[model samples]
Target: MSAGLLRNSFKGAASAAPFFPTLLDQIPNAIVIFEADSQQLVYVNPAAESALDLSRKSLEGHNFHDLFGDNLQLGEMIHEVKSGQAPAQRQELLLHSLPGSIHQETIPAHVVIALMDDSDLMLMEWFPIDQQLRTERDERVTQQVEANKELMRNLAHEIKNPLGGIRGAAQLLEFELPEKGLREYTQVIIKESDRLQTLVDRLLAPHRKAHVMEYFNVHEALERVRSLVLAEFPKGLKIVRNYDTSLPDILGDREQLIQAVLNIAHNAAQALSVEIEAGVAQIELRTRVARSVTIAKQRYKLALDLDVIDNGPGIPADIRERIFFPLVSGREGGSGLGLTLAQTFVQQHQGSIACDSKPGCTHFHIQIPYRRQEKSE
Candidate 1:
C-alpha cells in the first residue's frame, strides 16, 4: 500500500481500527504493527501468521525481539526509522524464530519498517525472499519449457515425413539390390531412419494422447514407479516410501503421473551407479500437502508436493540447468527425453517440476494443485 493511502486509512485511528486490520489482512506480504515505545506487537496480518507459523492471538502482546530473536541489522534499521534519522528503512535480512516455535528455521526476507503518521505505531512489512524467488523461477521455467515443447513438436513433425520417405526408399532399394553385400548400406540407412522415427514419435507422444482426468491417490502412482524402478535395480538400490496418507485424492491422468514420477526415479537410479555397487544407493518417494503454494504465478490453497530424493552423485553442472530440454543429457548414450517428457506430463496437469542438486544429494520437487472437477460438467 502507498504511504498516503495508509495515512488516510489511519486518519481517525480509534474509529478505523477494525477496518484497518481487515485492510492489512488482505495484503499478500506479512505485516506487523508494533507499539513504538513498548516495542510489543499489537497487530499481525494473516500473511504474517502463515509465514511465522504462529497464530496472531499468540503473537500479539509479545515483544518483537522475544518472538523473532535478536538481529542487529534489523534493530539498527528499526532504530534509524524510529529515531527520525530516516523516513523509512528497508533491508534484506534473515528473520529468525525463537526455539519451540512451529518453524525454527531463519527466513530470508526483504523488510521495510516505517512509522505510521502521527501515531505511536511502527508498521513493518516483509516478503519471504526464498518463496518469492522460487515462484519467479517456477514461472520462468514454465515459460521456457512451453517454448521448448513447441519448438520440439514442430521440429519432430518436420523430420517425421522425411524420415518415413528415407526408410521407404531404403527398403525399396534393398529389395532391388543385385549383390547381398550392398544390402548392408541400405540396411544401415533403414535402421538409422527407424531410430530417428522412434525418437520423433516419442517426442510427440504426450501431445497426441488425450488427457484422462480422474480422482486417484498420488501414492498409487508412486507405488507404480517404485515397483518399476526397484525391478530394474532390485539388488543394490532401495526405494523408500514416505507418504502423508491423509492427502486427498487428486484429479489427473494416473498414467501420466506415474510416468512422470517413473522417469524421475529411473534417472535417479541410473545416477546412483557407484552407490548401487557399494550397496548404499537410496531413493525416497515423499509426499505432503503443500499449503498456499504458488505455481507458475498462480496461487493455490493446497497442492501436492511430491519429492523424489536420491542419495547419489548429483546432476552434472553442465547439463543441470537444461535438464528438462529435449536432447540434453548428462550420461553417455542417454536419450535425454526422460525429464523433458516428465515435465511435459506434469505441465499438462497444471503443475511444475523443480530440481535441486549438490554432491550426494538431489531433489526433484513436483507440485500440482488439487482441484475437483465440476459435477455439473
Candidate 2:
C-alpha cells in the first residue's frame, strides 16, 4: 500500500468507528450490536444495560438468544438482518427472559442488520414501552401535583371554616327540639358534619404525616391487607395469596405498608363488586423475588415484587397515567387519595409502583428492595 492509501485507510476506519459507537451512545433508546456470524454481543450502550437490568460486563460476549429465549421474535429479526435483508423500519417485539424465573416484557425496537466492512453485524435498539410513555407522564404529574396542592388547600379552608359552625348549629337545634323525633334531624346534621370532617382528614393525610421507616416482613403486611379486604367483600370476592416465601424482610414502616397495600386491594375489591355479585370477582395477591431491580434511578441486588391483580374493567386511558395524583378517582364516591397515598408511601421506601391495565385485567406492580445484607449490631 502507498503512503497516501495507508493514510486514507486509517482515516476511514477512525471515522466509521467513532460514527457508529457515538451514534449508539447519543440515541435515547437502548442499543446493542451483535456479531451476526458469531451470535455474540459486540457492543451495548448504557441505556441497554439499564433497560435489561444487567451490567455491560455481564452482557458482553452473551448471545441474544441465550439471554432472551431462543424462540423470541428478536432472534428471527437477527436472522433476517444476517441474511441480507436490511430492516426497513422500527419493529415492536415482545421478549421473554428467564434470568432466574420467567419474565415477560414488551419492547419497541428499531433494528438494522448490515455488512460493515465485509463483516455481518446486527444493530438492535429498543426502549421500554413504559419509559417512552413516562416523559409525557412526568410532566403531567408535576402539574397535577401542584394543582392538587392548591385545590386541597382551598378546599380544606373552605370546608373547615364552616364545619365547626355546622356542628354548633346542630347542637343548638338538638337542645331546642322538644321531642325525640325532631332531635333526629339535628343528629343527622351532626353526622353529616362528622363525615365531611373525615373526608377532609383523609385529603390532608399525605401532606400532614411524616414517613417513618422500620424493618418488616412484606408477606405479613400483604396478608394483613388481604384479610381486611376479604372481610369487607366477604360475600363476593375471593382474595388469593401467592407468596414467594424466599423473599427477605424489607426495611419499611409496617403501618405504611399496611395502608399502602390495603388502599390498592380496597380499590380492586370495589372495582370487582359487580363481578363479585355474579360470583366472579377475583383478586390475586402475588409476591415474588425480583433481582437486579431498579427503583428511582438506583439499583438493588434483591427486590420484592408484589402484584395486585383484579378482574374488572381496566382504567380509562385518559386518566390512567394520572391515577397516582391526589383527587383523581375512578369511582363516584371515591376520594382518590388511596392510590396517591399508596404511591407516596412506596416511594418513601425507595420503591416504585406501576400499573398495567387492559379490558379484563388490571395489575398494580410494586417493587421494593429487600435487605440482602444485615447490619452488624
Candidate 3:
C-alpha cells in the first residue's frame, strides 16, 4: 500500500475503534453519538443508558428524533448539526418513555444536548440531568431522616426528664410560697415549661405531620430572612444578595420556606461571629433557576435554587453528614435543630437540601419547584 493510503487507513480505523466507549466509561456525563446522514444512534455510554433508564441494545439504531420525540429543542439541534451548522445553544428537554414491558412504568427523563462531530459521525451527547439530581436528593433525604430519628430518641430522654423535674419542683415551691409571690413563681415555671414544650414540639413536628404545599415567592421569603438577620447582627455582618430576576414564584408554604431559609442563614451568621467581631462577617443569599432536577424519583419542570453561603470557619468534616440531625451542634451551646428543621421544611415542599463545606466557606443549596400557575388578579 502507498504510504499516504496506509496513513489514511490507520486514521479511519482509529475513528471507528469504539472511541465513545472509553469516553463514556470515564466521563460522568451521559453521551450519545449519531450518524449524520441517517441521524441514527451509533453509540451510547453506560451513563447515557442509565440516565435514560434504557438498555444500550434497545437504543442502538434508533434515530435521535424517534428517541426524543417531536417538537423538541434537542431534535432541532441534531438537525442543525447534521446539516453542517454549528449551533451554540444548550437545549433542555423533558423525555417521557412509552409504557413497555421493561419495568412496565413510565419514566420522566431530563436531557441536555450538545452537538459535536468526529470524522463522519455526528456526536449528539444527551445528559441525564434529572437522574443525577434525583440521586443526590434521595441520599440527602435518607440521611436526614435517619438522623432525625436518633435525635428524637435522645432528646426525649435528655430533655423531657429534666423538664418534668423542673415542673414538679416549681409546683412544690408554689404551694409553700406566700400568696402574692406564689403567682409570680408559678408563672415563671409555667412560662419555662411552655418554652421547653414549644422546642420539643418543633423537634417532633417533622415526624408527626404531613407536608403542606403552597405558592409563594422565594425571593420575598429570602428577603424577609435577610432583613431579620441584618437587624440582629446590625453592624457586624454584611448580607449580600445575588438573585435571578426571572425566577418564578415557587410552590411552597410561605412560613415553612421562611423558616428553612432562616435556619440555614442563621447558622451561617453564627459561623461568622469571629469575623463579625473583626467587622468583616459576610453572608450571602443567592437564587437561581435550575433545570432537569428530580426529587423523590419525580422530575420537575423547573426548580428554584436558593443558596446560603458564608465565609467563616467551615463545618468540621467529621460531623458534616450528621449536622442535619437534631441536637448535633458544632457550637458549645448550639441546638442542632436549625438544619434539621430546615431539611424538614424543604422536604415538605417536595424539594431537596444539600450542604458542601470546607475551611473558610460553607454553602447550603436548596432546590424546590416553582408554582405551576399564577393566581388571577
Which number leads on TM-score?
A: 1
Q: What TM-score, to 2 decimals, does candidate 1 have? A: 0.77
* Comparison by TM-score, 2 against 3, better one: 2
lDDT of 2 by residue, 243-361 (tens): 87877778877898889989999998888878988998888889876655555556666677889999988888888977887778999888888998888788777777889898899
What tens-digit string does per-residue lDDT give for candidate 1 at 163-226? 8999999999999999999999999999999899889999999989999999998988888899
TM-score of each: 0.77, 0.68, 0.60
With a 3 Å backbone cut-off (N, CA, C), the pairs that clash in candidate 1 are none
- lDDT (Cα atoms) of all candidates against the true structure: 0.84, 0.72, 0.70
Clashes of each: 0, 0, 0
Q: Which residue runs of candidate 2 sit more than 4 Å off their true CA positions?
A: 1-105, 110-136, 178-181, 289-303, 316-322, 369-377
Instruction: Single out the weakest 10-residue window by summed lDDT for candidate 3.
Output: 1-10
What lDDT is reached at residue 269 by model 2? Answer: 86
What is the C-alpha local distance difference test score of candidate 2?
A: 0.72
Better of 1 and 3 by lDDT: 1
Ranking of all candidate structures by their TM-score, best first: 1, 2, 3
